[model samples]
Target: MSIVTTAQAVPSRLFAIYAALFESETGEIKDRIEAWATPPSLSGRGADDDGESTTTLFNNTLQEARRIGLVEDIDDKLRLTADARGGGKKVRDSEVYFLDYMRRTLFDPARALETQQSGFMIALTWFLSSSPLRPMNFSEPPQVGMRAQIGDHAPKTELTSLNRYQNFLYWARYLGFATIVGGRDADDQNARRVIPDPVRAIEGALPAVFAEGNDLPIEQFLTRLSGIFPVFEKGSVREDYEAMLLIPVPDPGQRLSITTSIALQRLADRQRIALTSLADAPTRILDFGSREGRVSHVALRA
Candidate 1:
């Protein structure tokens, strides 16, 4: 599987290719993609791929599109899948398709460890949900503070782990979940990376969290979100003939609650749903001032 690294505008460029193919009569896809790649406006904003030949980039994009099921080889010719064709009318539609496609394909646990893609997703989600206002340094590795916030169990020393976190932020920028602002001084290595609209990030991730026609209580939904990445106990367990004992585990419920609340508030701010306290009667509040009432439940609008 080809892992899309940081600083590459794979999604946009691929979408441009898909849209070009969808707009024209069927012919050699490579030739069409190569033509599309020649134009600066259609190619993408990434400077990293400038040195790469158009043919090389086209071949890489084609392979990735096939792997993600956006395109398929039919009778020795490359053709966009029906799903891709359905969303090919607009660039925004194509962008949405690419995100959903990558999410489903990359976030699977079976391939996550090998690909490190799932780790990136989880890290990006956490960053956006927890600290959207902060400016991040894209060139730097995952800081010790970030690792602590993510929990001590998170890998901090491994080169691959560090790369995964960095790549996660890079992917966020590529997908429009975040933005990268270049430093004013050409000599300065520090660039400001901001997630200006975390709500948009949540919107992209919502489909992964909820299924069509499925309604869940807010607590249950938050619990599900927290469990996206498994949290393991730090110590060992011992068993005897009569009893068994395991080391105590830290409670993550509070942290999950905070993260979930952030997501819910962002969604509400976007007018996705109205925030209201569930009331029992005209003059009575059933759960107000209670722990249960603190968490808001959402009802999807028609």
Candidate 2:
């Protein structure tokens, strides 16, 4: 699928809906859902031309939350599940646990691959990892011939992926990973640009890919890591000051291979976890190849 159209095809309000529910008191699920569905002028853009009202957004969010095991529907009342509540833990513990829960619920690649918007999710991952340092400009229309490089590759212009780039800005802002500066512009009715908040992304969304038990396969681990950190490139290039947006081109096979290797090493360096090979094979580095390879399994050190 082409990147541009994919962004427009799926618009997510899951985060907003979740935030509303998270902040509310624990009883009266029906009332809470109804109040959330009410169209507060500031909460969301009005209903779409296709009968997609605020109520529809809330309903979709509820269904998604339930599907991801974040909430339970009991006797017409909605409540956060034990996992969502962080197993009744203390505040900080609960926050971390819930952040991880949010990641699994909304951004898991396995689940995303099963949907129509899989391309959009992949595109989102690409943008986050590839452009972690670059801020996006949303005020002006996307310019043609703006260049960026991922890893060792030469810089390439973003002429082809303009829509996809814009879509990323919209989606990231929607999920609170990025915020629009100066509100909506008067000319195009879009934000001038967006400032990405890595702290917010980590605290709110990145933790979900990690688990305390059971080793994750390299592919799954990389997918989770990709969402946590942007791929680092050596030697900075001149920034494209004129471009109003940026989107990552798909990584070349070699670049992706190198990225995985780097991510594994970083994880090891931080002493946050342990990596092991499949079938008790011994290796220093985690190998992506060999179904029975060393880097195939990852888990928290403890």
Candidate 3:
């Protein structure tokens, strides 16, 4: 089972464990983190550790970390990986950590191969490759009935239950590749659905994509974007992960996703960027059903 199967391995807790360890230059013994992070719900319940006689919440999560190579268990202590150690030394930003180190590890081709492709990676690729006409709402609720959807797209992609799909949602949302939208009632999650919205992530990455320049070609923008967020269309993550699926993921056309198109349009409207199509230039069209649009170049505006 991957980290998704381990309920205690949610992103917040995972980062908590990671941050605690990151703050420690030297490796920390297992007990220190266990005592601090074990919720009161499972504080003294060793038996609740899924049959591990010597385990608690932290122990179970630590095992999950070890399986994914996030943490090394050596001489009964936990140490963050070398790659995870670098960056924001004094600050240890969770967003940066998750987007960079955690994301890279979770979807790593070799590691994911051994784990049979984590639920998050599988579900994400399906959305990335889905046509704009298809439902991108891959949530955890059965009322929406996404299990059959996955079956239709990739019959071999086995999501054990709604719990696994929920785990996928947690990771997807935390990473900013997806967002929750449109709900009549807060209690009714089925009333709402997760959509492929990477606006926040794109906004955060604006500086990197634009760099010193004020504007760049649409194709260049996508190239830089796919490098940072490899799960997006034409990204390396999709290339690597799609091999595992029995059915080839459907082609959603070569244009940007409907969600991404909306994100760009939102940015354009807010004057964060300018989208234009030159009279004679290579152009990439935004996938908006409401109207036909083409963006050959983008200008980053202050």
Q: How far is 69's C-alpha from truth in model 3 (Å)?
A: 2.6
Worst lDDT window (10 residues) for model 3?
Answer: 142-151
C-alpha lDDT of all candidate models, in order: 0.48, 0.46, 0.67
Name the lDDT of candidate 2: 0.46
The whole-model C-alpha lDDT of candidate 3 against the native structure comes to: 0.67
TM-score of each: 0.60, 0.44, 0.77
By TM-score, highest first, what's the ranking?
3, 1, 2
TM-score of 2: 0.44
**Per-model C-alpha RMSD:** 8.4, 11.2, 4.6
lDDT of 2 by residue, 1-302 (tens): 32134432223444444444455436346656657566476235557554556656565556655655666776867767665765453333344555556545445445444432334443343344433234566644333323333321212222245555666576555554556666665675755656543334433322455654456765565555555432212101111211123443233222333223444455566665666767754333422333222465667653
* Model 2, position 209: C-alpha lDDT score: 57
Error of 2 at 239 (Å): 24
Count clashes in each candidate, considering only residues at least 3 apart in sequence or on different chains.
Answer: 0, 7, 0
Candidate 2 Cα misplacement greater than 4 A, ranges:
1-27, 36-53, 88-98, 114-117, 129-179, 184-191, 195-302
What does candidate 3's lDDT look like per residue over 23-89, in tens digits?
7767788877776776556566565534533335666677777776667877878888776665546
lDDT of 1 at 101: 55
> What tens digits encode model 1's per-residue C-alpha lDDT throughout 64-178?
6665566777675677777556544533455555565555555444555554444444444445434444566666665565554544434421213444445455556665456
**Residue 126 deviation, candidate 3, in Å?**
1.8
